[model samples]
Structures are given as C-alpha cells and as structure tokens.
Target: MNILFIEDDRMNRRVVRDMLDVAGATMTEAESAEEGLQLIDTQDFDMILVDLRMPGMDGITAIGHIRAREDEKAKLPIIVVTADAAVDLRDRCIEAGADDVIFKPVAMDALFDAMGRLLARDSDGMLY
Candidate 1:
C-alpha cells in the first residue's frame, strides 16, 4: 500500500517509514501539512497518516481540506497519528474526517491493525 505520512519531526517519519517498509508498504514522507496536501494533488495513496501538530497547518485542518476536495480523493482514508492524549482528541479527529486515530509512539501491530480494519470497509462504508 502507498501511505503518506505528514509529520514535521524527522525521527517520527523515519520510524513510521521503517515500520511501513516491513509491511511492504511504501510511505511517502511529507514534512508539513502543506507539503502533504500538494502531494495529494499529484499522487495516489491507499492511506494517509497525519500528525496532530506540525509547523503551520495542523493535522485536523489538513484532513478537512482533503475531505473538501471536489474529486474522489476526498474519500481517502485518513488516520491521525498523534502523541497528544487529550480526552477529546479522537473525537476531534473523527469530526474532522479521520477514519481512525492512533496514538504515538505507535506500535507496529496497532498501526497494521488500524490500517487493515479501515481498508477492509465495505462499499457501504461499514466495517466488514
């Protein structure tokens, strides 16, 4: 699968990239939300993992922009990969269009499981 990870921290991106590599998934790195949005216009990805906080645009705002797209890309599955543990974080992410929320430091199994579940959705957008 092709995954786009939008994170400002270099180490965080590298760690996720290595994990994705093990799953035979190609992860395209984006250092910021703006860069990720631009990439979305030029490429296709099976999933998107966005950091909650970044320089300039936040992950929630990015997801909103993606969901606001005029094309089919608006339905792209998104996951919020955040370190924050705000009680309402998950709700906020879902409200902003994320399919799921996974906290950091992320475990490989957790990441794989979230991806598998979201990608396994049926045509009606229900979990299968």
Candidate 2:
C-alpha cells in the first residue's frame, strides 16, 4: 500500500520508514505539514500517518485542511502517530478527522494492525 508519513523528527521518520519498508509497503515522507499538504495535492496514497506536533501547521490543523478538500482523496484514512497519549489529545485528533491514533514509539505490529483495519474498513465502505 502507498502511505504518506508526515513527521518532523528525522529519527522517528527513519524508524517508521524502515518498518514500512520491511512490511513491503511503499511510503513517501514529509518533513513538515506544509510538505505533506503539497504531496497530498499531487499524489495518491492508501492512508496517511501524521505526527501531532510540528513546528508549524500541526497535525490537527493539517487533518482539518485535508478533510476540507473537495477531492475524494480528502477522505482517505488518517492515523495520528503521536507521543502524547492523553485522553484530550486523542479526542482532539478524532474530532479533527483522524481515523485512529497510535502512540510512539510505534510498535510494528500495532502499526500494521491499525493500517490493516483502516484499509479494510475503507474498502468495505464503513469508514467515514
């Protein structure tokens, strides 16, 4: 599957990249929300993995913008990968249009499970 991963931290990005690579999934990395948005405008992805915190245009705002787009790709599954596991933070992400949230450091199995579930729901037309 093609996935877009937006993260500001190089180390975290590398870790996720390696994991995805080993899973045989293709991924495109974005260093910031702006870059991620630009990529969204031009490419097609099965899902999006976004970091909650960034220097500018945080993931929540990015999710809002993404959901606001008129294209069908705007409805693509969005999973927040964040270090913050607080209840309010999770609520905010869901309210912002994220399909699911996974905390860091991300476990490979959980990441794959979340991706699989979201992709399955999306194919079954059960995702909103």
Best by TM-score: 1
RMSD of each: 0.7, 1.9
Top candidate by lDDT: 1
Candidate 1 overall lDDT versus native: 0.94
Q: Write the per-residue lDDT of candidate 1 for residues 30-122, one digit (tens) a residue.
A: 999999999999999989999989989999999999999999889989999999999998999999999999989989999999999999997
TM-score for all models, in order of appearance: 0.97, 0.94
Instruction: Quantify all predictions' global Cα lDDT against the true fold.
Output: 0.94, 0.93
If candidate 2 were superposed on the true structure by all CA atoms, what would the RMSD be? Answer: 1.9
- Model 2 residue runs over 4 Å out of place are 122-128
For candidate 2, the per-residue lDDT at 75 reads 87
TM-score, candidate number 2: 0.94
Least lDDT summed over 10 consecutive residues: which range in candidate 1?
119-128
